[model samples]
Target: MPGYLEVLIILFVALLLFGNRLPNVARSLAQGIVEFRKGLKGEPENQEEKKALPPAGGQQAHGIPQGTQGGANAQGSQPPPPAQQQDPS
Candidate 1:
């Protein structure tokens, strides 16, 4: 087992190496912990916010256009031809 002095030295070196990013690292770690706890309780992180927002009408959802939900290429456009490869002689 390492002594207290060895642990302190390791922590000091780590602080020096990550001094500038320590706060951001700590913040992200805290966020992860909160997310994990919410998951344990089966609670979504933004359920209330999602419910509060009004739905978007006549607009694309999940990148699919309003009338192109059931089929691909619903705009009557043809797919581009495959590129021709040249010989590397």
Candidate 2:
């Protein structure tokens, strides 16, 4: 266990290292904790409007088409082979 003096020294070092950004770091940490707690409790993250909206036509929830992969050649078709160039003698 650290003594009071040792704790104070550690805190002082932390303050020096984090100087102006400490408050922002603390705020971000708090927000992360709140989000984690909400996840544990199964609470929605303010996405009611998004949940109510319908998915676009022919698209899944992730916006990708239902029957196709996210590629131009999603229909299992292969590209045409390139033509060979003739060498000049």
- In angstroms, give how far residue 16 of model 1 lies from its true place: 0.9
- For model 1, give the 10-residue run with minimal summed lDDT: 68-77
In candidate 2, which residue pairs clash?
Answer: none
Report lDDT (Cα) of residue 42, candidate 2. 88
* Distance from true location, Cα of 19 in model 2, Å: 2.0
Model 1 pairs in collision: none
lDDT of 1 by residue, 1-89 (tens): 99999999999999999999999999999999999999999876798987876687755566666666756655646678899999999
Candidate 2 lDDT score at position 51: 86
Per-residue lDDT for 2-84 in model 2, tens only? 89999999999998988999889899999999999999998788889768877877546566666666567665476778999
**CA lDDT of each prediction against the hidden true structure:** 0.84, 0.83
Instruction: Give Cα distance to truth, residue 71, candidate 1, Å.
Output: 16
Model 1 global lDDT (CA atoms, 0 to 1): 0.84
